[model samples]
Target chain A: MIDSIARPTAAIRARPVLGAASVVALFVALWMALIWSPPDAAMGNVVRILYVHVANAWLAYLAFVVVFLASIAYLWTKRPAFDAIAVASAEIGVLFTGLTLVLGSIWAKPTWGVWWSWEPRVVTTAVMFAMYVGYLLLRNLSNDLERRATRAAVLGIVLVVDVPIVHLSVTWMNALHQLPTVLRPDLSPTLDPRMLASLVAMTIAFTIVYAYLMTARVDIERRRQARIIEARA
Target chain B: MTIARIWRIAAREALAERGHPDGFVAAITFVATLILVESLAVGPLAAGQPPVAAALFWIAMAFAAILATTRSFDRELEDDAIDAILALPGGRDALYGGKVVALTALLALVALVGGLLSGVLLSLAIALPGHLALVLVAGVLGLPPVIVLFVTLALRLRARGALVPILALPVLVPQLVAATNGTAAAIVGDATGALGWTGLLIAFALVYSVLGLTIVPTALE
Candidate 1:
């Protein structure tokens, strides 16, 4: 049913090159950016947190985009393969979100004078982490493949709708959280060019890592399903 | 024959699944305990900032809301009527809607009762007529949209009871943030100033209501 629509070989082949060159190019860029970027006079060595923290946060949304896309494909095509992709994306999204939270905390302890803040961004990140964790746990608890995929697809799509709202909430709460400078219309060079280079590099590296993990996870699921069928037959 | 009658039957069947009294007692007891803890926790900081108490108050409410949501669907699953109810004449939307209303009403009733008592406990002593009343009503009313969302997610969630906190907590962030802002403004004596927060809460409530309406049926289907 799935192979008729998507040649598994294409997806499987598309990974090694897209994933590897992208990752290698990414890390080299990070080395050039981080070691070469000028450090701010205000927070000397500590600013390194920006590269990791920012990239992880970017990846969180990226992973969700994948989960969303895969879910849409599953619903439209009714493909088991796409359901596996959605699950894989969600799982990766959770890990990256955790990384974001941890990096935020590490950065905060040194800069914000406290480990945690009621700031809107921090709280929403924690919430996103928990929501996706729930998504994965729900998938694990269900036994039926059709039921699990259908349910996960529904939950996955519904939950992604909350992300932008969470981002907006930090500003809406009038709290300590700052708005993103990079994506907004107005940009005053927030960081020196090197740090920006590091972030850009890290972003690509993490994305490649995300793709590799998702493919591996989905392949694991596909094989497990195949074995189940083989055992039955 | 009518959609109205279908709604009524759906409501009645859902109601039959969950018999009330015990859940009411549990919610009340939990909130009473929360109110006590809030009063004590903020008492030391009370002199520095009254608004902190208001913020503390709503955090407690958020926790209590989660606790109460479990009982909403726990009964149906416990008595093994969930599948039968899903297969009802109108299908899962009707049942999900009925559950949402029942849970929202139950949460509101409990939150209202507790909010009344917490109002006396906080004793901000400021002219919070606008802020206090708005926060009081909105805080309780604000819960239904949230309860509907979490309960809807809980339907498919593994560890439904345990999963409530996980799924609901993230979605509840804005609600909590707004409640804190609105209540803090009220507690600090600018009840009118708190109106913005209340308006935002209303907006959130509307969003969640639509979200619940749109998504719950799909989850059920």
Candidate 2:
């Protein structure tokens, strides 16, 4: 099994294809977001940040969903590959979450006139970021591979289950006494068709980029595990 | 039979804590110090407000729960008692339940002390004492399973002191939010709102308890 995983020739062959596709998609996404998309009537050019920001946020969540599923798979199968996939997705998820925060801050500055707000989405995303960072930290606490993976998988499952609850609680925090309709303005304004197209393009591009990163990272993890096994032998 | 075993394990844990009450004392002290410091930072005026007081109260309880639960596992680890426990039939789930029970009890005490202290220091009036107590119970119920699971997962790791909080706090955010808001609602006599938050807290407790039982065996391995 180790040998089969170590020599994933098909995946190896697909890496460059994924890389090239991601690059092409990203360039198209950037062109559409920066130029093709019309500026928002209210916020003007600042709205361009939404294309990338929303994509990053969406993919960050996707990465965590991958982590959650892979974690369950790891636990059920006790397979090293699933563990590798979970950890890689977690790392990428953290990076994307960080990027989402920065981009949101950038967008917030120009639009909301503040770099940060205690809005529900902002608070929820920040907590999500912290939770996964803690996941990575937990992964580092143990030197034993199987043990580490098992523990991290357990945590991954718990944290993923927590995301919706965290969002709900944060939303209710601000809207506790007030009627839902009287609460803060909806963050996503009605988008122009061109803007919608750009948003879709950016999301696809980001997903491709996530796929490319996961493939590379999982390969590295597999090799690392293989090296550990060889050393024991 | 499983229920009996779980109860016995929980009773054993309580007996162990009775023998050495240091962990309980330390946790209460930590909660007191945390509330005092937070109140000092927020100043007398803002700290006295119901919302701020509620937030400070739950925040202290959450951290206190972490301290208490981590020490509970640490005591088990010191004597290699966890392995002995796991050697029994259905031990993993029993152990999880036992820890959750004991920790919940211990944290409840910490919450009581923290609540009284916050009320005095933060000038938080309880308009509906019974509802506030119910909220505290629900909130405390939710914490132990999470604390037990994470602390058990971190038990054998290096830097566990730092790791337990890091791994547990973010997951505890919702509980903190619900407990804080519920306490605020209860303090202001909003029984409806407080009950709503209490329901959320109970749901959180039930979910994590079930999840903890399912995962503890794997976590132990």
Candidate 3:
């Protein structure tokens, strides 16, 4: 099945520019993040990791938002393309969320004096991570493509509801983690200007990487579906 | 008419459960074993350890609910009973509503058994019995509809036995947290906070049941 639908060499050749651009963007972003951004008042160098970590976290949420919309579209239209996008988005979202958790732990070790804490943000993020991992596992459960897509779309829409609830519940619980500095009800910026610029650059770089990976993954899924349909015919 | 139909389906499920008793028996045994293992591990709860007791109770009830839901759905799937029911008018809604009712009753029983055991063997005091009942009622009420929806989603899956808990539990964290906190409040004699937590559980139950009703047909397909 995989061999039958493997991405053609030419298609890969056409996307070399995107691949190169992402690598270049990430490198520049990393250089700016480490060297250009000023060290923190207290956290110093460890705070630099925040640029990449927070960027990946933001991208994970963005990817899942795409998944939620694509899943809804798949249900409304029964389109294979929408399902492919949703699945691809979910896979990428999970990857970024996993990275967020690891980087979070690394940050926590130095800052919170522990490898892990049941701080609301950490707890909710862990649950969100597990939920999407379950979503991916669920997609593999069915052999019937239509059934698989329908069930996964239903779950995708339903599970997205938990994201806000996780946030709400965490807020209700006393959060040991520091409250949000930037993304808040008030959108006033708080960081040093250079640091903010570095963070913004990293965010754009991560988003571009996400877009690139999602497109490639969706193309692979489109080919797989085409091959399957053709083989049946 | 719809209400009557849902009630009839729930009654039939109850009757069938009375005869088979696997889900009920398994849930009871599971909760009992949990309480026993917990007692052995902790070697009797201290007087002021309401939070510990509440956490143990919630964990036991949650796993028991998982067992009961899987068995309850498996019975219907075994004889293609679910397929036959789906072919009938209003079966999707009725089946979901009925499963919610039936599972709620089974879980309430498990909660009672677990709570009683915890009070006795673990030496934990439920200082406010009324609040404790409300906490249990709110928690048990919230689980069934969500669990029913998950069971439906897993019905056609190959590894449903493993998949149901994975899909259901994470979504249930809010409900479980509210319930556990409420139970702890009741144990610790914090009536106001316990009531607030119960309110949260009620809200969760309402939201999930409405959502489950809307999604059951699509998921069953």
Candidate 4:
């Protein structure tokens, strides 16, 4: 039985503020990226894609970190809220991971002269994407709520353990092959100030978007649970 | 005493396999066909082509390991035996340990058969028998825990056959790479270099073993 956890009946009131804030931040980020950031000396305006691509990649990682932590919290506390947060973060994580791959591909076409490369980071990122998708599929296979949460939590823990190992092995494999690193090796020293500023702004803006989506998604889950409990009673 | 009990459970599993032998039979049949198909694809191996042959052998061995794991763990789910075992004192630990031992042995057998089959069918000579065996042994040690955990995880699903490989293979990437590379190194008579990858295989084995022991109980529940 789910205990009636205290929640604001008018939780929708805060969403508009968060939503508007994210919207404003996102617009400012785009303006800064397109207008304020100077053209790249090396690649000209094409480098602007980094503002969107890198920020999305950061948000994807942040989402999975949320999934990982929320999974742990769910397992520890056995609370429905934690499970809601975990699944919400996972859904957002998958969406952003897909976006990151597409944006990276777009960036790669101009920079690397190909739409895709089996670079270590790219390969590991793809693998991670598939693994979390598997996590979602595994969760779907179970019908019971508690059973689903428990099993998904176990899989989440297992998947996170492999992330570091995959990163290490792929890095070593790429080093052995001596392939050119995809990300710039001279990033900090070579980066233009305006570009860095826009990138930083985009990062913050994307983070706010992620947080707002997560909260909104979890709130929806909370209402759904409450309705189910009310019906049962 | 726990170690002894773990061994006894492992021995029971081996004995059970000997009596029924369905999983072993299926794994061997699958490996045989896999090698035959791979041999056709790669075509007459040129001299000093152990890497290609090693890659084929590892792939076949991996599939065979997956098949054997599904059979082994699915049998536990039958007759509600897993529930009974979980009720025993320290049963989860013992069961995990026992399954690891049994699976390691089973996968090692498949690897041996696979390695020899590739050597013969593909005309790939094993220049360093001892070193190649060591690499196979080391890699197979790491293969089973992950496979067993995945097979157990897939038990609750309808698409057990398809889900096991999807969930397990990505995790096995490191072990697969290490095994293939180590086998190639051995075939080139580089015992010292092969040992480096063997050490890597051992590390994977240790990590997966600990992970299985700690998590399998919760997974089983």
Q: Clashes in each model (backbone N, CA, C under 3 Å)?
A: 1, 0, 0, 0
After superposition on all CA atoms, what RMSD does each candidate show versus the true structure?
Answer: 3.7, 3.5, 2.8, 3.2
Which DockQ-derived CAPRI band holds candidate 2?
Answer: high
Write candidate 2's Cα lDDT for A75-191 as tens digits: 999989999999999999999999999998888886777898887778778889999999999998787888999999998998887556443554555632112221125745356
Poorest 10 consecutive residues by lDDT, candidate 2 chain B: B1-10
lDDT of 4 at B161: 87
> Where does candidate 1 chain A have its weakest 10-residue lDDT segment?
A1-10
Model 1, B1-221: lDDT tens per residue? 33454376447644653655666677778877876876676564472255566666676677776666666567667877778866766556666566556655666677667766766666555467666677666766677666656666557555777766766767777677778778778767775668988988888777776666665656664
Q: What's the CA error at residue A170 for candidate 4, in Å?
A: 7.8
By lDDT, the best candidate is 2
Give the lDDT ranking, best first: 2, 3, 4, 1
Question: How does chain A of every candidate compare to the true chain A by TM-score?
Answer: 0.88, 0.89, 0.90, 0.85
TM-score of 2: 0.93
2 against 3, candidate with superior DockQ: 2
Candidate 1: TM-score? 0.84
* Fold similarity of candidate 3's chain A to the true chain A, as a TM-score: 0.90
Worst 10 residues of 4 chain A by lDDT: A175-184
Question: Model 1 misses residue A44 by how many Å?
Answer: 4.1
lDDT of each: 0.71, 0.86, 0.84, 0.80
Q: How close is candidate 3 to the true structure, as a TM-score?
A: 0.93
| TM-score to native of every candidate shown | 0.84, 0.93, 0.93, 0.91
Docking class of 4: medium
- Mark the regions of model 1 whose C-alpha exceeds 4 Å error after superposition: A1-7, A44-48, A109-117, A165-179, A187-198, A228-233, B1-20, B37-57, B78-80, B122-126, B129-131, B156-158
Which residue pairs overlap in candidate 2's backbone?
none
